[model samples]
Structures are given as structure tokens and as C-alpha cells.
Target: MNHAPASVWKNPVHFLAFGLGSGAVPKAPGTFGTLAAIPFFLLMQPLAWHWYALILVLSFVVGIYLCGKTSEDMGVHDHGGIVWDEFVGYWITMFFAPAGWLWICIGFVLFRFFDIIKPWPIGWVDKQVHGGLGIMLDDVLAGFMALACLQLLAYFF
Candidate 1:
């Protein structure tokens, strides 16, 4: 069912940008990329908050390049199969989330909702931005929105 170009497999940058092949899925590639991010979140969960934040920042910076390069190679701006953005976005959403499956699931749903719905500034950025930063910023906004909701839920409930 994968319509992803063969370049996704042959190119290392494309492979990573494609969420380690998860983005190659024919359906809901973004969702699959976010799902692929879970194991990484689990590994990072044990780190102190500052360390996690550091990694998050680094990931975002690197993602800009990765997404940009892959998009260039593919001749498509923000291709659905290039999902490094989703991975970073999901990580942002899970930042400081409680250590439990329930919280993880909630964070995932909230992130997916915001990413998919593309409300307000998220939608605005999606339209206005271009290239790799464009590919990443919208998802970054979605992650922050989802994170806000997650934090509020954790605080009140």
C-alpha cells in the first residue's frame, strides 16, 4: 500500500525523515510516525527534565535540516512520507507527561487532534511557511498546544 518512492529506502536521510520507514505506510503516515515515536519517548522518559528538553531542542533543530533535505531530494515540499516532523512533535507533546500508558495515550490523541485539525495559528503557519521549517513549525505548534492541554489535565485531574 506504500506509495513512498524507492528513494525513501535507499537514502539514509530520507529513511530517518520518514520516521524509520513508519511514514511509508499508505494510510495516516503522520499518525504512524507519531506512533513510531513512542518507544523513543519511553527511552527518554527516564532522563531528567532538563536533559529531555535539551534533546527536544536538538531534535527540532536537526529535524529542520532532515526534513528540508529529504523534501529537496524528493522534489516535494513536506511530503506525507517525510515524518520526522511528527516524531519531534509527538516528543514535544509528551514532554513532562506523567510516567504511565494512560498519559502517553492521552498525549498522543491530543497531539494527533491538534496536528490533524490544524486550528488557528497552526493552520496559518502551515499555509504561510515553506520548506523544512514550514514542515516542522506547524507540527511544533500542534505539539505545544497538545502539551498545554496535557499539562492542564495533569494539574487539575
Candidate 2:
């Protein structure tokens, strides 16, 4: 585990990218980062879909810079400690999901599964891409895949 210095948290970019310090938990940081996003997801759940989408887009755009900058500071590309991508990715996964804790838990599990498994292009991009874009893109794909599954489940059952 390539842990960032304590002072790294002083930087707002690092703080956010690290999922408000959840990424520093020393065990399953990505999982913890995704967990940290749940409250924010709930807060956004009541918004109009357009507003929710706008927020997701903005988060992704900002995350590119935030993740990149933090990675640079830590001198590790896509370091495990940089998990703002996971937060936004999980949020994206839950988009249009049905109400209730059951849906939320399902979305969470789907997002984590795709993210950790990194199938096909997700795995490819993770290996080939570089910098902030790389840090966020793979997770974005994972979220999209999970969202598709969630939406399908909602439609069928």
C-alpha cells in the first residue's frame, strides 16, 4: 500500500480524491470509498434526473483533475489511496435506480463487482490509459455497466 503523507490531506484535491480520508483506511480502501459515497448518493436521490445527471457529469470532470493532481502529489499513478473515482463511479451506478435500501445495496454490490473484476474494455483502459483520465475512466465504465444491470433489474423485476 502506497500511503500518502498526513500532510496530503491538507490539500482539498487530495482530501476529496481520497474520499474524505476513507481511502486511507488501510484495508479495502476502494470499498470504503464507495461506502463513503452512499450518503451523498442519498442526498442526490431526490433531485430531478437532469440535475442528477448534471452533477454526475460535473463530478467526473472535476475528478479528472482532482485524481490526477493527487496522484502526482503522491507520485503514483492511480494510487489505491486516490478513490474519488470510486465515489463518483458508485454515484453514477445508482443513477435511475429504484428507491429503497435493497436497490442501493444491489447497486453497491454491482458497482464493486464490475470495478474489481474489470472486464473487457474496463480492464483494457485501466492498463492503457494514463493520468487523471485513466484514473476515472475505468471506474466510469464500471459504473455504466453496473447501471445497465441495475436498470435491467428494475425493468424486469
Candidate 3:
């Protein structure tokens, strides 16, 4: 639980990588980061799928740099406070999500579960990768897992 100092927040990379300070929370920063993503997901829900995908891709690309720089500054690898990955991950999980709070809640739960549990390939990636890409990859895979589950649920019911 690396609590980055106030000075670290001065860096734009740190600020954004920290999920606009939601990651600064002493407990469950990743959870808070995912929660912070919900409103953005709601706001972007209306965009065409391609546009939404574009933004999600852009976010992931930028997150690689932002997370890496912030991690360097903090002197910790994938510090808990660096949660931009969570923000992007949750957004990915919610892509094409069915309309309703129930689905939203489901996405959130599934993402967090996969993220925290890091089952199979997600766990494999977390161990085999390093640096900024490493920080983001596990969550990205978690998002994919959640998205798959959400889509399947929507299809079934």
C-alpha cells in the first residue's frame, strides 16, 4: 500500500494514473478507481461502438505511459495507488453492457472478482509481464473476462 505523497500528485501523469485521486484512498483503491469509472461509462454509453472502442484503446495506450511514469516516480512497481488500469478495465467491462443498473452492478462485480482473483491467464500475465504493460495487462484481461460474462448473460436473459 504505497501512499504517494502530495508532491507526486503534482505530476499530470500521476494524477491521471491515480484515477483523479480516487486511487489515493487508503483502502481498496482499485475498487474506488473502478467506482470512479462508472460515471464516465454512463457518459460514454451513448457513443457508437466504434467510437467507444477508440476511446478505450486510446485510454489503454496512454495508461501504459502514465502508469509507468507514475510507478517510476513512486518507486514502486504497479503500486496499489496507480489505478488508471482499473478505470480503463471497468470501462472495457462495461462496453456494450446492457442498459440498467443491474447490468452495471454485474459488470462491476465480475471485473473486481476477476481482477482480485486473477484467474488463469490473467494471473499468468501478471507474473510474466513487467513495467507499465504489466500493470495494465492483468486488468485488461480481467475486463475481457468480465465483458465476456456480461455479454453471455445478456444473450441468455
TM-score of each: 0.97, 0.97, 0.97
- Clashes per model (N, Cα, C within 3 A): 0, 0, 0
- In angstroms, the error of model 2 at 8 is 3.4
Candidate 1 per-residue lDDT, tens place, 1-157, comes to 4479898899888899999999999999999999999999999999999999999999999899999999998888888888899999999999999889999999999999999999999999999999899999999999999999999999999
- TM-score of predicted structure 3: 0.97
lDDT (0 to 1) per candidate: 0.94, 0.93, 0.92
TM-score of 2: 0.97
In candidate 1, clashing pairs total 0
Candidate 2: residue 83 lDDT (0-100): 88
* TM-score of candidate 1 to 2 decimals: 0.97
Model 2: per-residue lDDT, tens digit, 1-157? 6566684568888898898988988778999999999999999999999999999999999999999998888888998978899998999999999999999999999999999999999999999999999999999999999999999999999
lDDT of 3 by residue, 88-149 (tens): 99999999999999999999999999999999999999999988999999999999999999
RMSD of each: 1.0, 0.9, 1.0
Q: Which prediction has more favorable TM-score, 1 or 3? A: 1
- Error (Å) of candidate 3 at residue 18 is 0.3
Q: Among all windows of ten consecutive residues in candidate 3, which has the lowest summed lDDT?
A: 1-10
